[model samples]
Target: MKRTVLPFVLLLAAACGPRYGMRVPDKLVEKLPYESRIELLESENDLALAIDTVDEASNEVLRARDAIRRAKARESAAEEEENRAADTASREVAKLAIEEARARVTYLRAKQRLNVGLRDVEQLALRCAFARYELARLQSTRKAKVEGSEKLDVKKYEGQVSQCEAKVKEERAELAEDSAQEKTAREAWEVKKAALAKKTFDARASPYVENL
Candidate 1:
């Protein structure tokens, strides 16, 4: 709980790639009574934010689709790499079969390389938990002077802590899921490889037996 800075989530968000600015003109707010105008403005802001989010997500999807198409259309496209494993709705179904892992090419590539270890996952989870603890400690402290100055909002701090806890839960879930998937994949691969080796050995020894 005695951390020196904000949680890594906030820092990571700050360090991530640039995002398109979503500017909604203030002129969209209607002229009305104080309370009614405030309500209208808030609603307009929420709608604008939602619209921006959808637009960004749509653009991302389009970019991903286009990239896949380009990869498929390339002259040097490998046979298995260019397979249209799934369009969109069939991705979940495609995962059940392992022949052409077009959608999971990145995962396969990472599996072939050095990847994050369990210790990293545990460290991140611990840091997030500590961040939540620190937030709770701050909220529980008797420092009302900061609140009196209109700088500290108890509700806001509580919300931040809640978000941190949710993140901790999410990290744990993802870690568990990834670990299970890795174990399953390795087990299946081992079974297949052992069978293939046995068949190969038998084939090589078959001609010798016939000659004898």
Candidate 2:
């Protein structure tokens, strides 16, 4: 009977184990400050990556714009030379259309990337603000708990807390604008992608479509 009961208890434990995984207990003192510091560090690292992404995306946008300009110039030259030869002009125009479409796609993708990077930066900014608030709250709590200490008095943490609260408010205020910009980027990308998809379909369906 004892062995059977032990097996049943082990099975119950195994069934419950996966729900929460391993739960590590924290120390009783100053957990909020410690956790907030960790979050702040992580957000700062992510913000660095987001900035790099924005830079790369900006460069890609420039390259794509240059490509579009070159393609347009070539198309213009081809149009001017159309009176000399009809067949060659048609092929050249088709080729330039494809090139322009591809360049536009690249530009749209770069824009989307930039938008995502900006959104990430805004989100991380908010996260950092919240973390700062948490750390300040912890400091205020600790200071209030201290007794007979001139350096760490009850009123000492108020300024820090107020500054952190202001930062949080500023971040929140920008959230709506950030969201709108991201939405605009997404909508533009989708529209351009759909239009380009139709052009691609038309080009593929053409029997005259060649390597160019």
Predicted structure with the largest TM-score when compared to the true one: 2
What TM-score fits each model?
0.30, 0.34
- Tens-place lDDT per residue, model 1, 56-129, is 54554455455445433331233432356445423322232232223233333223221343334344444344
For candidate 2, write residues 85-128 as lDDT tens digits. Answer: 55864655455455444444444455555555545445444333
lDDT of 2 at 24: 16
lDDT of residue 175 for candidate 1 = 63
Runs with alpha carbons beyond 4 Å of true place in candidate 1: 1-130, 133-151, 170-181, 196-212
Give the Cα error of residue 198 in candidate 2, in Å.
Answer: 2.4
Scored by lDDT, the top model is: 2
Candidate 2 error regions (>4 Å):
1-150, 202-212
Model-by-model lDDT, in order? 0.38, 0.44
Candidate 2 clashing pairs, residues 3+ apart or interchain: none
| Number of backbone collisions per candidate | 0, 0
Worst 10 residues of 1 by lDDT: 19-28
